[model samples]
Target: MKESIFHRLYDTYHQDVFQFLIYLVKNRSVAEDLSHEVYVRVLKSYDRFEGKSSEKTWLFAIAKNVAIDYFRKSSVRSSRTFDAFDWETNQLVSPTKSPDALVELNDDMQELLLALEKCTGDQKMVIVMRYFQELSIAETAEILNWTEGKVKTTQHRAIKHLRELLTNDTVKEAKSHESK
Candidate 1:
């Protein structure tokens, strides 16, 4: 409730919460709006926070719930594409590559993001949390309020689905090239 504690929470967890919301909603603007809402709710409920979970994990759980609420209220999904560049690295996946090679790598990463879009919502969440966000399985399970087994199963299935989607895309591209 205190302004200083609220500011501290925003400073510490805003980026992580925003990233999770962006992955969930697929829109930066919506994520930004939702990030504000997450903090607002956190401020309102701060006194009730029992501190059973780490603050970061607690913030993510709130973010996930806020995203779900947005989906429910709007009954529409944002079609914004994922930005595939790693935020922390501030460079493409392979920085040492030549310009053309870097472009190719970017294309591949974008294609992978598109493939991820094809996954079911739960699978997508599991993949983003486990791989993209680099959260541990236990942490992801906590965020999703799922049992660890459920998180593991969803992660396994998501990976399998991603492989299939990427392989199919590669085949389609190859076929197109062959025809060309």
Candidate 2:
């Protein structure tokens, strides 16, 4: 039974979980490690799962906590005074996509990813779950331990922020090219 559950989770959620982690971390190797951690957590807690939420949301919840823990530990280790989860960095790195995916990612998509990096952690999480992962509002709320209303509000704010960021970037690029 345990083996079957393991197989089912691997078959169903492995890629989605990895993608979610990769989007958050902006690094392939780190996402893989986090994905593994999520799987381990689910397996350990499977028996205790009360079925109040769907398996997907439960898995995502584990992934979300794992990411928060990673950022916290990283911040502590680096002696950063600020909360890393909410810190915005202009030098935020782009997420690593497969070669095939890289070929498909255009300038707009790159800009969008950068804009996403500038968002607060809650905004980013809401966007990634609602848009990137194609999860419903309720699922996102369950995963984030928030209300559906909060999820909708965060997503709206995130989209508006992204639009502003992308528009400004575009204007700057156009001006630079004109100057050249």
Candidate 3:
């Protein structure tokens, strides 16, 4: 593959691919390795890419497959949980926010991530692609090899499940505070 073409592809889709893998595995190092593998596969198969879909869609499809393969190989150990990410101290900072506000925001983000962990694999994939990666429904369907209706249904169910989990968490926290 020509260096320019490869560079363009990397520049256009690398971050999206990395983010998708990170969301799937909840581990930055694993995600980075998978992202590199995706690029390797793309370079090998670039000539076979027919123009049936947009390049973005094609790239995402490749990424989704790579992540799936990683999951399959590590299924026995896949139950590993995400470490607590310090959102307030991460790059998503707001200087105007008070310390209390920053801590609240971090807590909320952590809660949402934890809630997402309870979803089934299919539901989690749709949720990450649709919301976290900000892909459109059509693009998500193409990447997942599902019908548009299936994508919509999966996203709806995932959102409902997440709401239930987060609500339960909130209730439990409230009860604990009351008991305190």
Candidate 4:
């Protein structure tokens, strides 16, 4: 039973957890390593899982905690590693694509990514889980081990901050274009 449960969770939530960690950390390699670490911790704590929450919720809660621990231990260093996948990559496509389409896509992607970078970690996690990962509010709260109210507040703040960043960016771009 224990092994079956572990297998089930591994299959069900592995990809979601990986994607979540990738967005949070903004690095593919770190996300992959942390995803594996999350599972290891989950396996060790599997026996301690009481029935207080659903299995999915419990697993995500563990993942969230692992992410927090990772951030706590990690030091922020300037690195160009993740820049390979930055918004500019979205502009490049096969010969089949039109130049206008590429330009529009790149502009939109750049704005979104820039806005995302401006968000606080707490706000970013909420946005990533809820919007990017498509988790429900309850599930998000469960994963973050936060109250529903807290989740809602974080979501609001995230959106507000993102909007401000986008607005400011747009103004700057317009001003630069006008100057040119």
Ranking by TM-score, best first? 2, 3, 1, 4
Candidate 3 residue lDDT tens string, 100-158: 22244477776776677667777878888888899999999998888999999989988
Higher-ranked by TM-score: 3 or 4: 3
Q: Which is the leading candidate under lDDT?
A: 2
Candidate 1 clashing pairs? Answer: none
User: Candidate 3: lDDT of 173?
Assistant: 90
Residue 66 C-alpha lDDT in model 2:
94
How many residue pairs collide in each prediction?
0, 0, 0, 0
lDDT, candidate 4, 1-180, per-residue tens: 878888899999898888777666655666788888888988899889888888888877777777766654442222324333222112211112222322445767646654776677677778888987898999888877789999999899889978888888889989999999
Backbone clashes in model 3, listed as residue pairs: none
TM-score of 1: 0.80
Which portions of model 2 show Cα errors greater than 4 Å?
80-104
In what order do the candidates fall by lDDT, top score first? Answer: 2, 3, 1, 4
Query: How accurate locally, in lDDT, is each candidate?
Result: 0.73, 0.80, 0.76, 0.71
lDDT of 1 by residue, 73-159 (tens): 454223244444222222112111222222444777767666766677678778878877899999998887889999998889879
TM-score of each: 0.80, 0.88, 0.82, 0.78
